[model samples]
Target: TRATDSPSPDVSPDPSPSEDGDNSEGAVPEGYLGSWSGSIDNASGHSTRELVIRQGEVGEAVLTLTAEGPLATGGTYRCVFEASLTAEPAEGEAVRIGPSTVTEGEPMASCTPGSPTTLTLLPDGSLSRENTSSGEKLTYTKSG
Candidate 1:
């Protein structure tokens, strides 16, 4: 049988559901909430950032980044970022806004987020994300 396409690809007047019943409740997966740590380095120096994600019922995730410096004048710094994520096509997914990653590295990420950050957990307990604007690839390794 031939499949028909919907007129509007976005914000369709009629919405459909998925198999996982992800839409049962508009919220993020419980697994997304937790702490992720990674090492970040640059020409300036090396540093680390730990993210503590707190999610709400609506799949909204609040992240806190405790970072050190890669610059000569750099020192230990902490940045707090709040973003509301929504799995529009499904559920438990979200989009966020933030700085773009300046560079890439091992252990952790060196740069930042371009737009809102989209973070997903990997089976190995690592969090991988691509900076929205710059598309700088970053993967945060687990500390424990």
Candidate 2:
């Protein structure tokens, strides 16, 4: 199980699908702030990623990197993966993402975008993404 009680920062509940359809709990589930990481391996190579999705003022999920890499590209990546459910550097979990693409893939695509990745809490207290960017599935996991 994940180490600390963590929660995504910005999660809109009761959002109408057309307008919004999901019936999410108001704000992220309790204890949805902490660290999470994951990794990935494909034809290109392998990489590890870790993010500290912490609570912010007015209760918004913010990403504070605890672990990254050298020469990693710089730019806010579409943090479409959930903190608990999908961000575990698991082998098969879909790291579905969006417009935020490194294009170059590895080596240069290491520096994560210095922005708060919008993390939404799922009803199951897990996390998920929508219209996330399509990039190399760099499996990252929480270390701290």
Candidate 3:
């Protein structure tokens, strides 16, 4: 598949709280409730990525990532993954995603097949993600 031909992931906005004040089970952290999009260019190629964070059914942060770009073998591909937020310490409560699970496409050799990932939310409402294993770093801005 080509990068432009890749299907856009379903990115719904955060659900509104119920009328009866019953948001206990689905209360997502304020800082992590939005859609972010960005692209990274490197020697291999450029990739367009989107990240969506929303409240989970059990009052946890659910993060979904969709990335599409060219492959080393001369074609394009898309991959999607989902993860739940876990505890971590950072300058303003970084939102970490993991024990992540790939939800689409074959696992790329560069990214950790089954490891946790962290996303640092800057004070200016931007996001920074770094994959130490693959030495991949990307900066994303909040999407309107």
Backbone clash total for model 1 is 15
Structural similarity to truth (TM-score) of each candidate: 0.55, 0.35, 0.65
- For model 3, residues 47-137, the per-residue Cα lDDT tens digits are 8889888865432448888888877877777788787766543546656665666678744654444466667777787888766456566
Report the candidate with higher lDDT, 1 versus 2. Answer: 1
Per-candidate count of clashing residue pairs (backbone under 3 Å): 15, 40, 0
lDDT of each: 0.56, 0.38, 0.69
lDDT of 1: 0.56
Write the residue-wise lDDT of candidate 2 on 1-144 in tens digits.
875666655465654555521443323333445566655443444444555554332232234433333332343333232222223222333331222323233344343443223344445544443334442223333344
What's the residue-level lDDT of 23 in candidate 1? Answer: 54
Provide the lowest-lDDT 10-residue window in model 3.
Answer: 19-28
63-134 per-residue lDDT for model 1 (tens digits): 555665544555444344444454432353433434433333322333343365677667786787666656
Task: Show the lowest summed lDDT stretch of 10 residues, model 2.
Answer: 95-104
